[model samples]
Target: MENLSLGLMLMAVGMITVFSILLIVIYLSKLLIAIVNKVAPEEVAVKKATATASAPTVIDPNTMAAITGAVNIVTGGKGKVMKVEKI
Candidate 1:
């Protein structure tokens, strides 16, 4: 009976120690995240609300003709360029 009681006491103590350490780790991690976020905050890119972003760019008539001709030649006049996007 004494041996069984001693075994139970040791198991309880070991489990409590592990549980306490895990709780401490959780709180410390939360604290570290808060400190890091507050110190070096992320930079958000704030773009100006411009009419240019939504508008389509005008291409010179000759340049458009050349691009259209080249694309038609490459695809054997099968694929047509519906819209040209400039980066």
Candidate 2:
């Protein structure tokens, strides 16, 4: 009876140790990712909404065709994309 109890105790301790190590590794990885994101924040170009509203949009012939085809397929050939513009 004592031997069986000792074996179960050791098994529980081993599992707890493994779980603790996994948690520590996960914490360290998250900390590293946070530090990296802070150091290298993404660059977003913000334009004036009023300026965007008045700009002349131009569509490439190739892109327009591809977009039309994709849209037609996605809409089950029921509709099409009339235009695609590069801003």
Off by over 4 Å in 2: 1-6, 43-65, 69-81, 84-87
For 1-87, candidate 1 gives per-residue lDDT tens digits of: 999999999999999999999999999999998887788555421232233552666666798899999998999999888887666
Show model 1 residue runs off by greater than 4 Å: 43-87
TM-score between model 2 and native: 0.43
lDDT of residue 35 for candidate 1: 88
**Shift of residue 36 alpha carbon in model 2, Å:** 1.6
TM-scores, each model vs. reference: 0.44, 0.43
RMSD of candidate 2 to true structure, Å = 6.7
**lDDT for residue 61 in candidate 2, whole number 0-100:** 63
Compose the digit string of candidate 2's lDDT tens values, residues 1-87.
999999999999999999999999999999988887788654322345435653776555686788888888899999966555555
lDDT of 1 at 51: 36
- Model 1 TM-score, all chains together: 0.44
